[model samples]
Each structure stands twice: as structure tokens, then as C-alpha cells.
Target: MNQINNLVRHTRLLEIVGDLIRVRALGVAFGDLAMIENIDGDQSLAKVVNLDRDIVSLQVFAGGKGLSTDAKVIFLGRALDVVYSDNILGRIFRGSGEAIDGGPELPTDPRIPVGGPTVNPVMRVMPSRMIETKVPMIDLFNCLVESQKIPIFSVAGEPFNQLLARIGFQANADVVVFGGMGLIFDDYHFFRTAFENHGVFHRTVMFVNQASDPLVERMLVPDMALAVAEKMAVEGKKRVLVLLTDMTAYADAMKELGVAQELIPAVRGYMGDLYTQLASRYEKACDFKGAGSVTILSVTTMPGDDVTHPVPDNTGYITEGQFYLHNGFIDPFGSLSRLKQHVVGKATREDHSQIMNAMIRFYSGAVEAQKKQAMAFELSPFDEKLLKFGRLFKERFMDIDVSLPVIEALDLCWLTLSECFDPKELLMKQNLIDKYFPKSAHSEAEEGETVAQVA
Candidate 1:
């Protein structure tokens, strides 16, 4: 309340629908924060969401409740910014960047502008470093590369939020920044407790928007999360991994606004510019050339688990790749990380590619064998072998609960393969088979161990 309204204040309301307010104003820029003062001297915050000649439309962050047409509106003269500091780590903030955990305000002036321009391509370095999450489905199969933008595609009942929490603790990054939109109190508490119990809260910052918050603020969570991450990577010189959950909710927020504006619907009732709106946030993923990097891992839940849903469909176009979560596991055949080859063989072991291919091939074979059995066909010796390999693969590697370093998992992979078939049955190089086939090896642990050790 002590903050000064150091600019001209307008007392007019062109329209008031939902949380949006349109007023007569001049020289108001997009994304600028505005203060709406009620007749009772109570103030609420809003952000300039649109502008047309002399009329500026603002999204009231605190919702458009108890305001009159005569309420005073003051523009803050600058784009929306979230306070930046190392002190934000381990703290929980609301969608508007206010600390919601009863913590003291993070001190001022270096505010990071939300939804800033994407880092220039000329300044970006090729994303080559692998970001290991100690999850076999990720580090071992489709490796997550530093500065990569990827999403977890899952249905509503799937445990995607749990997977995000696992990555928060297991990902090899200097800091973790989480943005949760439209989450219920239980989901919010789950993330907090998981991070705290895992002892990674000290290096994480959470920006959350609960389901009961106004839809407009839900739209700001990604921007706030990314802005804070940009500050941390560029200024603090840290490798930052940003995790956003349920981007489908964010898209729904935009769709609500579009409906309120009486705009024609595009794909599945989403805005026609949905792709552009999503790309603006996802393209923010950057390697930052020489300073540091900002990597993104987000969840995009599909309606009815349909990949054709507009949100996940558009997301696939902007992100590098996606992880498909199904049946309590990241489906190995469905998930992909496009940048994995940049480091899988170069940064990882020489046999990394061979081992990866062989396991999937064997798993695919196992699936076929199970199908044959379903049809009541007589099983052959080779079919039985594949059936056994398939079962072990899911148990040892595909389960989300299975957490092991890349090398440790690889060693176990060889153990799994060896237990299933003869050396020639693997169809691997005889030289590699001779050198690394567990029995002739000095120690299987030492072989797979050094490949991804530095990741």
C-alpha cells in the first residue's frame, strides 16, 4: 500500500468481463503492470495484456472482483518483471511472483522481464552436453541434452507429476526451477515435500498457480519461471533446468480469454495463434553460448490420452522431442530425445549406441513373442528367450521407480542380455562381445561406469 502510484491515473472502464478490464488510455505498452484502486482505497494488480490505439486491456492478477467503472487505473510504465536473486531458491512464489510461503520479499531492482525475446541463434551454442536424470528411460535410452526443450506426454491418470519431481532431484543441473499451473493443493504440497525430503529444495525455486487462482495468473507462471531461470543461468552462472507441469492448463487459460474476446476457434477450440503462443515460451530454451544454459522439461497432458489433442500436438512441433509416459513407465519406443546422438557416443562410451539399440530390438522382439502367445501359438525356443528378455527389461529398466546411473544401468543391461541369450544371439560385434561381455571383463561395473560419469 505504501508503493507510490508515480504516474497519471485514469478513472474509467470501457468493459469488465471476467478478469479482463479495458480502459481508455494512451501510450500503454503490452505486458505492463497496472494498479486498479477501488473506491475504498484497496488496490489490486493487473498486467497489460493487449493494446489497440487508445484502449488498453489488462488482466487483473488478483481477479476483477469488487471493482467499479469509476475505479482508478494506473499503469506501471514497464513490462511485467519478476524479482531475481539467488535468495529465491527453495522459496515458493505465487503466479504473480509474490512469495506465498510467508517468506520475506526477495530484495529488488534486478527484475527479469517476463516473456523476453528468445536468445539469438547466433549467440547459441550447439546443445551437445548430456543432462543425465539417472532414469534409464532418459539417460540410457533417449538422453536429455543440456539446453533441450522436451515435454512429458501423458494421460490424466498417469504419474507425470511424480516423474517431474523425480527429475527435479535426479537431474544433473546446478539448479532446478519449477513452475506449476492449475495445480491443486495436494499436487503443490507433493512437489514441496518431495523436494524437501530429497534435500534438493535448497537449490530449487518454485513458482506455482493453484486451481482456484484466476485464469489470468495461470498464464503468467511459465513466463515467471523462465524469466527467473534466465536470470539464474546468465547472471548466476548456473546450469538451470526448468520444470513446468500441465501446460495443457496454460493453453486452456488462453482459450478462455480467446472465447471471452469472441474470437473464432482454431484447432479443437484453441486460438488460431496457439502455435505461436506456445513457441514463444518453448523457444526460450537456450545454451547461452559460453555463460551457462537453461533446459526445459515440461508436462503436457493430453485429453483422453489422445496425441492428436491440440495442446500436445502443437507442443510436439516446438520442442526437441517428448517422453511418452504410459502404464507407470516411460515407453521406450515412444519417447525420443533428438539431441541424444550429439553426446550419446561422443560424450558417452563407445558401446553406448550398440547397447542401446540391442536392448530396444530385443524388447521389440519380446513384444511380438507375447502377441504370439496371446493367440495360443506354440512357443519356440527363441520366442521363449525373447519373452524372458522382455519381462526383465521392463522390470530392470522401464519402471519409473528404477533409479540408477547411466553406467550402472548399462552394466545391468549387459547382465540382462547375457542372462537371456548366447553372445552371437546379441548380434553385436565379436570384439565388443569379447571385451565387455561381463565374464571376460575386469568388472562390468567399471566398463559402463566411466561412459556417463561426467554427465
Candidate 2:
């Protein structure tokens, strides 16, 4: 408030609207943290979300069920802040930044406000570097470049969480900030256990809002996680990989809160500002011109697998690209990384782009051959080869369980290609083939000689 503390306390008139409290306090700034003291001497967290002429609308993090008009509202004179430090790694936090892992509080750690400004574009470098997750679906097909904002689009019954956990352990980034919104306790445990077993938790900070947590907290989970990530990337100069799962839940929380606030519904009953709200978070992905970067990989589940649903639809507009996870695999036909060109060939091995394109192309052909076979048509020799290659390709690389370095994955591509057809039939660059083709795909005489030498 602009006035002295006594004047601020004198005008403490307010009214509660569900979870939102309108306090008629003058000169109150947005994002100012506050507390509502109830008659029972219990205080709950609140933050300034809207500022009218002189009335400030505050969203209570803990619902306002027990609050009253006469409750003493105390403004903390600052934005919502989260405790930050290297000590935060391997820790679990609630949406309000309180520890929930039976561990001691981290109040002594340095504090950083949530939802800070993103890195200036002029100060940001082009995301030319890649972060290898060792998952062919990502590393080979849609390379995860530094600071790229992307989402995994999937339907229910898909293994997006498993895929995310795999990436968390496999990515070579210096730090991992995992924000799990509306996750079941089991999923939360799975992420924690996966990171622990893989030895990545020591470099990870997890902020979770379980399905049972307050709806308001669920909305803040992403901001809190990104806040910590920004700290590590800017001050610590670390490559931070932020993994947010099931952002559909995040949007749903917003819808529920908007309904609570009596806001008009827009497209498909979602709040009208859905796109802007999402971009504010996704836009936080940044690659500092000289410092480290923050790359975002999130999951947004589609109801009934409908791409046109409000959440994923708006996300498509904000993020750089998306990984469409469906039918237990990352869909090569649907998945794309717009920034892959900056790294696939330039940063990876010279054959990375060629192998990626070739593999997906063959996979498409294999699908056609399968359709023809299903029609009871006699398969040609080429069709038969396609059938054989398709099975091996899926088994060796496409399956989510199949994890390998970019080099090994590329080598496997050549093996599957050779097993399907002669080198001339591949239609890849002649120079690339001659330079990078595997010896296993060589002539029969050369292969036998190699086998004999091995024997």
C-alpha cells in the first residue's frame, strides 16, 4: 500500500467471493503476497491477482472457506516468492513451496519470486545446440534443441509419463525442473523414484500438485517450477530441462477457478484468455545469449484424442512444436521439432538428419505394405522386404523401451535398411551412404569375410 502501515490497517474493509477476496486497500500492487487471519488465529496464503480503482482482488491459495469479512488482511509487501538454492534439488514441494517429503523446511534458502520476467529476446541466443534424451523418437526424429518450447500431445491410456521419466534420466542437461500438475500420488512417486534410481534427483527439483491439492495451487505449479529453473539457468549458468506433465490439468484448473470467479467461458467453455495464459508460461523457455538455457518439454493430454480441444489447440500455437504420443509410441508422422535443423545435422553426427529422414520414410512405406497385405493382395518382393523391415524397425527403435545413443540408433537404422533392400534401393544421398553406411550392409562376399574374420 502507498500509505503508512497504520492507514493500511485502518482501511481493512473487504469481502470474500468464494476463494477470491476483494480488499479495499489503496495503492496495493499486483502480485503482492498477503495473509488472511481468521478468528481461530489461523492464517492462509493469498496473492494479489487483480487491482481495480482501489480494490484488490486476491486469490487465496488455500480456499477461503473459513475466512470472514472481518478477518485481518495483512499484505506482505512483495510478490509470491519461492525458496531457491542448490539445496532444493532432490526435494519435493507443494504448490505453495512448502516441503512435503517429511523433510525439514528450507526457509533459510535464498528466495526468488515466481513468474519473473523472461530473458530478453535481444539477449537470447539462437537455440542451435541439442539436448540428447537418447530416445530415438525425440533425439533422432524430433531433436530437442536448447530453449525450444515443445509439448507431448497424447490421449488417455498413453505412456506419456513414462516417456517423460525416461527423458528426465536420459537428458544431458545440467539441471531438471519437474512440475507435475494434478498428478496422482503414484505418478508422483514414479517420477521421484525414477529420478532417484537413475541418480538424477540430485540435480532435480520437483514441484508437485497432487490431484487432491487445492485448485489454486495447481495453477501455480508451473510458475513455481519455471521460477526455480530460471534461477538455475541465469544465476547458476546451467542448462535446465523443465519437464511439465499433463498441462491439460493446469488449464482445467484455470477453467475451474474462472468459473468460481464467475468469468465468462470462451471457446469450448474454457476461459477466453486461455491462449494468453498458456503463452505466459511456455514463453519462459529461454536460451541466454551467452549464459545457459531453459528448455521446456511438457505433456498435454487430449480428451478422446481430439486435437481440436481447447488446451492442446491453444498450446500448438504457443509452443515451437509438439511430440504427438499415441498408440504406445511417438507418432513419427505427427511428431515434429521445428528447430531440429539447427542441431540434427549441424550438431549431431553428419548422418543424423539423413538417417532420421530415411527411417521415417521407410516406416511410412512399411505401413503401406501392411495395408496392401491386409487386402489379400499378393505381396511383391519389395512389399515382403518392407514387411520384414517394418517389424525390425519398430522393435529396434520405435518402441519406447528402446533407448540408445544417436550414433547407435543411426547404426541400427542402417542394419534394418540393409536387411530390407540393397544399398542402391535406399534412395539416400550417395555420398552419405558411401561414407556412413554400415559394413553389415556390404556385399555378401565382404559380409562373409567379415563374419569369418570375427569367427
Candidate 3:
């Protein structure tokens, strides 16, 4: 009971105007944590809405459900803080930063405010270093550069969750923080075991808001996860990766709140401030002035695979790049990381850019070849070569199971190119071909008369 009292305190009431409860107080800060208490025979959850001139407003989290005008509101007198320490690694927490796995409560520390301002532009270092996940499709082509904000735009039932898990397992980061909003029970369990099984849980912290949890709580997970991530990066933890899944849920929660508040609706029944809300989170990925960086890789699932969905449409404007996950794979043609150019050849090998471009160009041709074949069009000899290259590309490079470092993936690209066509047909610089082309291609060329014959 003492703990409960410490968490909730009384202050002089400034005014109670309609649903708004205003109070004069001290030690109340913006985003400072507060909890609802049953007073005047009321039972409901409440959220902190406004803190001004040491006065705080407690907006009922449960929509003032079962709460009378005289209900007691308690201020914790401290900002919302997440438990941050080495002990947080390998732990699963609810949206409120409470342990849901029946583990001991995290030790208290100085409260850290959530949803802090974005890093200043002058302080942000230009992103150059690559954060390798060793996923062939991602590392080889759509590289995850440091401090880049990219989204995995996928549809439901696709392997976006698995892909995120794989990246979390393979990322060479000092720490990984995962925030799941409105995830189902299966996805929550899958992330838990995937980290545990892969031995990466030792450096991972997860804040999950499941679909069964209170809807209001779903909106808090990102702020919680990003706050911890910012702290870790500021402490010089290099390569801090923040993974958020299903931000669409978070947006929907915002829309629900807007409707409850009777605000005017924006496009698609979303709030007018949807873009600002998303940018606040996405812009949190920054390379600090003197500290380590925070890289954000989030999943934004499209409704009915519609790219024009409000969530993804607004996301596309704010994020640096996107990985399009389709039909259980990262679509090579559709997925893109705009920051890849910053690191592809400069941070990686000289052939990194060349190979990525050539492979995708060839794959695009293969797509056209596939269309031609489907239509029963007469295939040119070159078109036939494209068909063969496409099939091999899908089998060797596009498949999610094929994992390799960026360099090794580039090597496989050369091998694939060599196996399908002659050096001249590849349209690559003669110098690069002489340097990186597989020896098998030269030997096969000695036996074969032409590129067409090889295909």
C-alpha cells in the first residue's frame, strides 16, 4: 500500500472543466508517468494528458469508465521511465514496461521521459556505416545502413515476421530492442523463442503490446522501445537496431482515440496528425553528434496489400527506404533501401554496387521473359537466357533461406552471371569481369562455343 501511495499523490485542483481535470502540482513533467486510482468510488485507468506550470491533467485511460467527477488522480511525480540495465536484455515486457513473464520486477532507476524530441539536424552525422544482417537479399542489395529509417512493407500472412526475426538474430549490433504493437499471441511467442534459440537474447530487449492487451497500451510500445534504444546509443553502444512490427496497429489506435475525442477525420478514417505521429517515431533514428547511432527497421503491413493504405502511404513519405515483402519473400525488384548507395561500394567491396545492379537488372529482364513465356510469345535467344537467369536468381539469391554476407552474396552474383551468359552479354566493365568472374565461367567458355549454347 505504501508503494501504491508513493505512486499516487494528491494536489490542489486548479479546475475541472467537463471531462478535463486540471490540477496544480509540482514534480509533474510532460510524459511523466502517472497511474489512475479509485477515488470517490470509481474504477478505471487514466493517462496523463497535459503538464503545464507544474499542473498536470489526467485523462482517463479507460475512457473515464466507471469514474465519477470526484475520482482521485495520483501523480507519480516522475516522468515515465523504462528499466534500463544489462538485466533488461533477454527480458519480455508488456507495454507498460512491466514484466509479463513472471520475472522479478526491474530495479528502479532515474525516470527517463518517453517520446523525447528528435535529434537535432546539426548534431546528426551522415550515415555511412553498414549494419550487416547477413541476409542475402538485404545485405547484398538493399543494405541496412546505419541510422537509416526503413520499413518492411508487407501484407498479412507474408513472412515479414520471420524476416524481422532473422535480421534480429543476424544483425551485428551492440544491442537490439524490439517493439511489437498489437501482435497476436503466436507472433509474440515466435519472437521470444527465436531470440532465445538464436542466442541473441543476451543483447535483446522486447516491449510487446499484444492484441489482447488494452488498446491504449498499444500506442506506448514504440515510445518505450525507442527511449531505451536512444539511451543505449547515447552510451556509445554502436549499431543499436530498433525493430518495430505492425505500426499500422499503432495508427489504428490513434484513429480510435480521435473518434472517441470526436475529432475530425483525415483520409481513411485516420487522424489529421497521422504523418506527424509517424515522423516523430521514425525520425528518432539518428546518428548522434558524438554518440553511437540508432537504426530503425519497422514493419508496416499493408491492408489487402494496398500500398495506398493510410499507414504505409504516410510512412513512405517519412522513411528513407522500404523493403517490400511479397509472396513469402522480399521482392527483389520492389524492395529498396535508399541509403544503400552510402555504403554499398564505399563501405563494402568495389563490386558490391555493380553486382547488386546487374543482378536486379537481369532479374527484371527475367520478369519480362516470364511474361513473354506466359503469353506464349516467341522467345528470342536473349529472352531464353533471361528466363534461365531469373529461375537461378530466384533459387539462389531471392530465396529467404539463402543467407550470406554481403561479400559472399556478391560473389554468388558473379557466379550466377557467369553461368548464364558470356562476359560481353553481361554489359559490365571488362576490368571488373577480368577480376571477379568465376573461373568456372572461363572453363565452361573454353568448352562452349557461345553464350546461347551455355544457356
Candidate 4:
């Protein structure tokens, strides 16, 4: 180890394999960022991935291509840090915190370190508030509670990214931090354009690692997004929503690096610490004691639509719940929000809990009715009603394009139920039915009139 401006520098490389390098250097800490300058004057960045006594192993950000054995490596004695300020909002940055939006260069003041520990348990408050996303299925059924960490589990070819962008713009929060890993140019452009066109770009910050970028940057996107979100929630007293797309990519990046470092592979070639790495990011969602909150809603694409896949399997144990996305709709039966109990009837309308339950119960019955009809069983009059209700349910509430506030969604739930079943058939509390059930205007005469009008 040689000292240049009090920073540790090593001028020899013992090994260079697939973007990984080993050097005999002292005083190097894990996760420390170092500058790797080759003799050709081309410089790149690397991070200390492993440290064993006097030997340090780093993963070069720009890859170890055409590199000599004696490149100068300078350890910065600090972990990866991202620039943070009010100007960071509404800006687009790469996973490495570099501005790629052709905007003016931002000052490097108040750079905050990424990949920090989770918030203290004592400093976290119980999540009791709701994040209204104006999506009927999410807002009315699976309420997105503040400070809740959840994922939208889906597979490829689904509109999960579009759904994510909708929530990013429509969600009720003081700020939105979006982290996109392994996105193509089209998907990246879609998110930016969606936020801009929907008038949320002013308060949205995006950290993107495109498919063509270095694999190491994919793992940095979440850490950068979460770090900025935590800073805003704790220090700026702003409610922040962090949206990460395709956590599978992040996990795959870890597996690739693990293989490069010759570490023992866990299940499916992933590193053994996949769960810990995921929990560290998801746990960033917390409501500060006296400050604002950080709520995380990420997308985890299951390979081959297998929930048993290690990424989603581990995530299921770590997150509060998941919104299962399939066939371009948020599957009501497959989706859940475990933290919704804290806010269902408390922060929302009194009829929320009742409406949610009755709708789902009836929908389940409707599905069974369809199955019975398909198998050539005799259909009862009630089964006919269920069939009608099922169609209206999918058309009105389940569609991803349908956007309604929580209150309006609750009212619509009542209308949809009334169109098919009598108030007594709802099986809800009598008092709730008395207060919210449709009156004579939605009764037989009006129902006949509605049919006539449609006819």
C-alpha cells in the first residue's frame, strides 16, 4: 500500500477475471469505492467486494477489459455515495448517480452513502395510513398501507411496468423515487414519458440501469433509490414512495457477481445471502417516529411464472404482501396486503372492510358458478345472478385501466352488487346495508329502465 494524498493506492493486480480484480492492499474496507486508472490513461471505478487481511478484491464498474497488470488502484476510503438535494427530484440518473438526462451538471454537495442499514426499530411507527393509488383493485380491495413493503409479482409480457408507472404517477405521496433495473430503452422511455405527461415528473426521481449497462449497476439502483427515499422521509419530512421494477434483475446481478468471485452458489446459482440482500432493501420502508414515511412497492417478475422461484419465494417471506399481476389484471384472489388491517376501516370509509369482503366472496362464488355451468350442472337462479355479477365485476373493477378513488370505488362496489343481487343477499352487516345499499332509484323499475336504455 502506498499513500497518495492520504488515500490508499495499490499499483499491482494479482488477478483480473471477468470484471473482478485482486490486489494486495492494506486498509481497504469492503464496499469502499476505488478509482482504477490504467496506464493508457483510461480511468474507471470499482468497489471493494471482499477484504481478507491485506488482500482486497474489487469488481470494476467498467469491466476488466484490455487492462494491464499494473494499473493504479486508489481506494477512496468511503462507500458508494449518491448526490442528494432538492434538485435531484425530477431528475434522471443512472444507477451510479450520473445524470443521463442531458440536464445541467449538478453540484456534488451533500452526497449521501447508499446501501445503509435499515431504520431503527424504535424509530419506526406502526403503519396506519393508506396510500390511495386510484386503482380500483388496489385501493378498494388490497389497500396499500403507508410504510408497507410489497411487490407486484408478475411474469414477462405482462403490463407490470405500465401498472407500476400508473402507481408512480397516481399514488398519493409527497415524492416518488423510481428505480428501474434491467430495463430496455423502450421501457425506460415509457416511464419517463408517463411521469412527464401525467404531471408527476416534478416530484419524481428516477434511477435507471438499462439492460445494456454494466451488470454491477443493476444492484445499485435499489440502494440509490432507497437511500434517497429515506433521506427525504426522515430529514425532509416528506412522504416518499419508492418504486423498483424487476428485482429479479437485481438478484441475477448478485448471482453473476458471486460466480465471478468463485463463491459457492446457493439454490439456482444465486448467492446464499439473497434473502438478506433483499430484506436490507425492503426493510427501508418505514414510517419514522415523528417524520414522514417511506413506502416501497416493487415489481418482482417470476421466471416461467413460478412463484416457487427463489427471488419471489424469498420475497414472500420478507415483504408484507404482494399484488399478484397476471393476464394484464391484478388478480384479486392472488393479491394481498397484510398491513391493510391497520387502515381498512380506520383510515378509510366504514364500509371499506365490508365491501371488500363481500365483493371478493361474491367473485369467488361467481367463479364457481362459471365452473358449474361449464361442467353442465343445473344452474340455479342465484347462479344466473352470480354469472351477471361476475361479468360486471371484471368489466368495472378488475380492469387495469379503471381508475377510481377509494370512496368512489366503494360506491361503485355497492352499485355493481345491487345490479345483480338484492341487499339481503350481500351477507354484510345489516346496518351497513341499510346505510350504503342502493335505494329505489337503483331498484327494479330503474334497473328495468337501465336495461331498456341500453337496449
Whole-model Cα lDDT per candidate?
A: 0.89, 0.87, 0.82, 0.92
- Say which candidate scores most in TM-score: 4
Estimate the TM-score of every prediction.
0.94, 0.93, 0.89, 0.95
Q: Per-residue lDDT of 175-261 in model 1, one digit per residue for the tens?
A: 999999999999999999999999999999999999998788899999999988888888787899999998999999999988866
**Candidate 4 C-alpha lDDT tens digits along 1-455:** 24535775689799999899999988778898899989998988888998778888999888898888889998888899999999998899998789999988887568988987898899999899999999999998898999999999999999999999999899999999999999999999999999999999999999999999988888899999999999999999999999999999999999999998889999999999999999999999999999999999999999999999999999999999999998988999999999989999999999999999999999999999999999999999999999999999999999998989999999999889888887767889989887888786346745776799999
Which 10 consecutive positions of candidate 2 have the poorest summed lDDT? Answer: 1-10
Q: In terms of TM-score, how similar is model 4 to the real structure?
A: 0.95
Q: Could you give candidate 3's per-residue lDDT for residues 262-343 as a string of tens digits? A: 5699898999999999999999999887889999999999999999999999999999879998887789878888888899
What is the descending TM-score order? 4, 1, 2, 3
lDDT over C-alpha atoms for residue 334 of model 2: 92
Write candidate 2's Cα lDDT for 112-191 as tens digits: 88996667789888889999999988888999999999999999789999999999999999999999999999999999
Candidate 3: lDDT of 154? 94
Candidate 2 residue runs with Cα over 4 Å from true position: 1-15, 445-455
Error of 4 at 409 (Å): 0.6
The C-alpha local distance difference test score for the whole of candidate 4 amounts to 0.92
- Which has the greatest lDDT? 4
lDDT of 3: 0.82
In angstroms, the error of model 4 at 30 is 0.5
